[model samples]
Target: MGKPYRECPHCGAHLDAGERCDCGEPEQQEQTAAEERPRMRLIAVCREVDKDTGRIAVICL
Candidate 1:
């Protein structure tokens, strides 16, 4: 039988006995949080007035 095999945690590479893994390499860790900014757009605004001369608006998208 071949040497025991195990799956690498970082790159998912199959590792065998006496093999080295680059899971701790800097390049691989850099892209983990690559500024995945979200995109949003303003939808609409609603306004209402009361007898006390107050204004309230509810925004909805």
Candidate 2:
């Protein structure tokens, strides 16, 4: 099943989980802020060799 949908109280627009309608109401602003918050992710870099030829490639994530 998909996430339940909610309606914006101010604009009566449909919203998904952690989503806000375009009305930008104060109540929705807080949710939007939390959703817009920056998050940290792990990136990996590695060296790989191709089977066809003897070469090294640097991969960046």
Candidate 3:
């Protein structure tokens, strides 16, 4: 017989009972937010430039 296991909701990793996944932890969340901040700021800047130039700015992500 095998022991039962469960899936981690944040990362879909298999975990034993009473175990927790770090994927949803604050540290990882903060890192993700930090990574996204620059991209968002770039988009905002591009929008402002486009408005001033009267042309669509294409951002390749």
Which candidate has the top score in TM-score?
3
TM-score of 3: 0.35
Per residue, candidate 2 scores C-alpha lDDT tens digits across 1-61 of: 9648988888788888898676764677778888898987756555788878977676657
The alpha-carbon deviation from the true structure for residue 10 of candidate 3, after best TM-score superposition, in angstroms, is: 2.1
Predicted candidate 2, C-alpha RMSD: 8.1
TM-score of predicted structure 2: 0.32
lDDT for each candidate structure = 0.71, 0.76, 0.71
TM-score (all chains, Cα) for each model = 0.30, 0.32, 0.35
Runs off by more than 4 Å, candidate 2: 1-3, 25-61
Clashing pairs in 3: none
Candidate 1 overall Cα lDDT vs. reference? Answer: 0.71
By summed lDDT, the worst window of 10 consecutive residues in model 1 runs over: 28-37
Deviation of model 1 at 20, angstroms: 2.0
lDDT of 1 by residue, 1-61 (tens): 8547887887889888768787767774556555454556787776565658676666687
